[model samples]
Target: MNASLLLLIVALLSGLAFWAGRSRSLVVAGVGGVRTLNSLPFYYGSLTAFWCALPSLVVIFLWSIFDGVFIEKLVHPLIAPAVLEAAHGNMDLVMNQVRNLAASHVSAASVDPSVVAAAERLNSLENINRWAQAGVALSFAVIGAIWIWLRINPQLKARAKVEDIFRWLLFSCALLAILTTIGILLSVLFESLRFFQRVPVTEFLFGLEWSPQTAIRADQQGSSGSFGAVPLFAGTLLIAGIALLVAVPTGLMVAIYLTEYASPRMRSLIKPVLEVLAGIPTVVYGFFAALTVAPLIRDLGLSLGLDQWLAISSESALAAGLVMGVMIIPFVSSLSDDVINAVPQSLRDGALGLGSTHSEVVKLVVIPAALPGIVGSILLAAARAIGETMIVVMAAGLAANLTANPFDSVTTVTVQIVTLLVGDQEFESAKTLAAFALGLVLFMVTLGLNYFALYIVRKYREQYE
Candidate 1:
């Protein structure tokens, strides 16, 4: 019996015990003729149910985490020295392998009989777990029934007690989610700190280049792992710039059309169609950029008599950025449409009544009112453009040449991270660790943008609301 099944079994039994206790108490209190409760039998049932379920659920929760460690300790001491050494130091891996071997139907090459025996032992442990589950679930039900019976009285405050427990449970669940996010950020920060210790923090932050390739042995000691990150940062900024240039104005216009002018039927039709752009997998956009968009741009440039050496390739930053903009179009359009529509209709009407044209009212009153939300949406889209992986990976080149030309190819940080961690690279090396460092920087950048957006929204809200 796993923990979830045990929790559910306890909850069901608790509900039943609650019903029994409430029915008996109602009969004793003269609220019913040897029958139901006055405050609704279901409410009483629920109250008793919560009590029976809550305490045992807490116990099951605590037991789940500590039980495995305790069981492993006992099992290890019982094993022979040869078996223990053969299992290797990875207890979890050995346990998983044993379980798989026990369950598997196929016999492969290099199969050992000792492993087979260990697998058999695992089967025995499985049976033991089933028995323990049944025993514990029964114990919980019996104890809960007895406790509810003792607690029931004619004037008992069962409803309030149930509510208190439920409120605390919900609060604890919310806190758990927030704590998990903090835990993840802290872990990333610590790894980045380690990376910075080996390579100087100032060099990483302020250096003008980024190429993480270093020597392995003394024979090849002098290698350039130039931590200067200016070019990569500039490449990211340039790609994101091109993406926004395409995405913002087009998305805003679409939003205005949808919100201010479209009929109800047209809106229902158009909103879903716009969202379909969002739903298209990003990898598809990458393929389109590499195959279709890049060639079109290159041909257009040739027609204008541009240098062939400087023309866009299939993997140019412009191709990737344009595709990425198309991918995030729904984000800008949908968010802007909602915010525009949310502005009171009376405001638009007032402007029209004061001898203003429809376009004039939209440009002067509606847009100013909705500007904060629009800015927030644009910021989010820019951040998305910066962090995107698949579109850039399939379309942008791996070279980080610092140039302002939209036709030239450039690499993004995400593409670098993927290449660094690909195949069988050593994890302890600086090249791999640099990915974590880059992640930490990316986190900080996005966080700053989000906070700035919030500040603008708050200031605007203060003036308007």
Candidate 2:
């Protein structure tokens, strides 16, 4: 059976088990009634459904994980040793060919006779494994349901057992999330370490040039590419600074207007419309930046004769930063709105009672009280702007120039990372591995921002409480 169909069947079985357990509990209650039971009928039903699903899901999960390795072992003997020798003893290549042949991705006539034979064997074994897995899972589900149904009684601690099971499941999910983050960090760290082995850490960090192009052949031009990242860092900061300039004051003003001045009806109408900006895809924003904003800026610059004093590129950081600011406006506004609203009404009233104007009350009482959260939101938005890729790619030209001029074309760390990892790349090469090094640095920067935000939030929260 296919996975989807098997999952549906298990769900139906669990539903049936729930019904059976509830009916059985009612029968057991008898003349004494449900009051005599240790737990409610719902708990019994839940316990039954939990047992019926958990074991079956575990079996499916484990089987899906190891079945490929098991099938590979079974198929290994079927491939001729001569074929392995011919492939320079590269097991992965042979396996790839085998998988392609088995999946009919490659024509059988194009494959060797021995590989063709192994493909057929692999196909057969996979079919058998799927059926076996389905059968075993169903058996476990049925057995678990039956065992729990038989043990159902007035004195059974069904609620406690179900709660304990759920507590552990929640803990497992939290642990899994933590482990996944650790796995990402470790993977990036290891790959970056390999990159640092080829290129010096000091050069990567401090060198002004940002070229990462290495020649594939020794005779090719640019054989020893520069890995200096300073230009990229400068470009990233310049663009991000421009974006913050556009976003911060505008978003905060909007939040204040909505929170302190607008009527309930106006707030209701404007808040949703403002938040819709957040839902628009970044690529759509990118298209707008490239085609509309960039040209408009270029034309305006030409008309105003600013080109005499400064250069205006068709694709400049200004266009990208402006559009990115618009994109993240809702992020800042929404969070600031929430924080501003969280300020104590009593505090505002106290300020007003002291003969302060509405604006004064807002500025002195509300904003100060919510300063920590507002700062946190701005930092979060800054992180969002820094890590943005699609908008930067389309609007900002991919030239890592270290300049503060927003009218000049520039690129960011994310843009460079995407450029470096665009196609089939050899992992052993410094050119490809540079993407991971950029990622590690980006990760650390964002991590620090988030940690600092949390620290500010805790410190301010204690004072307020």
Candidate 3:
């Protein structure tokens, strides 16, 4: 049986076991009195389901892992020598042809009788394997159910055993996440080292020009792509700085107003409306930036009669930054609002009791008390702004201009990373490896921001508490 079918059968059996176990527990309790039972009826049901499924599931899992290899081994020797010679003695190639023929997905233009015979043998073996696995899995399930039913007495510690299994399952999930993160870092690190070998680490880090067009042919000029990443870094910071300039004050003020000054009805109505901005996709924000905000900014800049020097492109950093700032406002506002509200009422009362006004209570007591969380919220929004690609792509043109002017077009690291790895390209080339190097730098920047936010929070948290 296929995995899905097997799982469905096991699930149905487990469900049946649950009901049976619960009913059995009730019957036993009626005879011996409920006080004699060690655990509840629900615990008995859960434990029965666990017993019915766990061992069988493990066996099925192990069988599935080895089934492919076992089937290949069984079919390998059965293949005619002519078919093996046709595959140039390559087991993998022969196996691929065999599998394709078995699945009736042959890609070759010509057919061979030897391959056809081997495919028939392979199909027969697979059918037998499936039946064997199904039989063994069902037998394990039935045996486990019978064993657990016989053991389901008043003295059974069903709840504790079930809880122990759950505890291990949760730990395994956490371990999987940690392992995945480590794998990503190692992959990026190794690829980045390869990139650094081709292009000097100093040049990648500090060089100002940002062209990464490596030619495939040796005869092509500029094939040795300059991997200067300073422009990307500068563009990222410039746009992010502008976004923070707009977002932090506005979002913090919105949070302060909603939490401190606004009436309950106004807070209820306004907060949700503000947070709706977060649910809107970044692409929609990009459209709004490109069609509305960018054009408006350009016209405004031109209308000021300072056209001699004041130039604002339609896809300028200012447009992307402003829209991105608006997009990230919900992040800062939502987090800061929660943090501000978490400040104790006692602190506010104490501040006011010292002849301080309501404004003084908010500014001195509430804000300072919640400063760490507010900083954390701002940093989180800054990170969001840094990582945003669609907005920068649509609003800020992908020109890696290393300039400080917000009115100029610029690109970001994420935009270039997408550009580098979008199509089929040779992975060994410096052009492709450059993406990993960019990713590593981006990861480090984000990690540093998180660490800095933690340090600030820890340093100031106790002082206010």
* Most TM-score-accurate candidate: 2
- In model 2, the worst 10-residue window by lDDT is 456-465
Q: Report lDDT (CA) for all predictions.
A: 0.77, 0.92, 0.89
lDDT of 2 by residue, 271-363 (tens): 999999999999999999999999999999999999998989999999999999998898899999999999888888888999999999988
TM-score of each: 0.83, 0.96, 0.87
**lDDT winner among the candidates?**
2
- Candidate ranking under TM-score, highest first, comes to 2, 3, 1
Output the TM-score of candidate 1: 0.83
Runs in model 1 deviating more than 4 A are 2-29, 32-40, 75-134, 214-224, 308-311, 462-465
Off by over 4 Å in 2: 217-222, 462-465
Sort order, lDDT high to low:
2, 3, 1
Per-residue C-alpha lDDT of model 1 across residues 213-312, encoded as one tens digit per residue: 8665458666658876667777888889899988999899999999999998998998999899998988899889988987787777778777556755
Of 1 and 3, the candidate ahead on TM-score is 3
| Candidate 3 wrong stretches, greater than 4 Å | 28-30, 59-140, 217-222, 305-307, 463-465
**1-465: candidate 3 lDDT, tens digit per residue:** 777898899999999999988877887887666677889988888888888898889889899899999888887777788777877888898889889989989743466776777788888988889888888998898888888888888888888988998998899889989999999999999999999988999999999998888787678675567778999999999999999999999999999999999999999999999999999999999999999999998888888864677556778999999999999999999999999999988888888889999989888788888989898899989889999999999999999998887888999999999999977667788889999999999999999999998998888773644
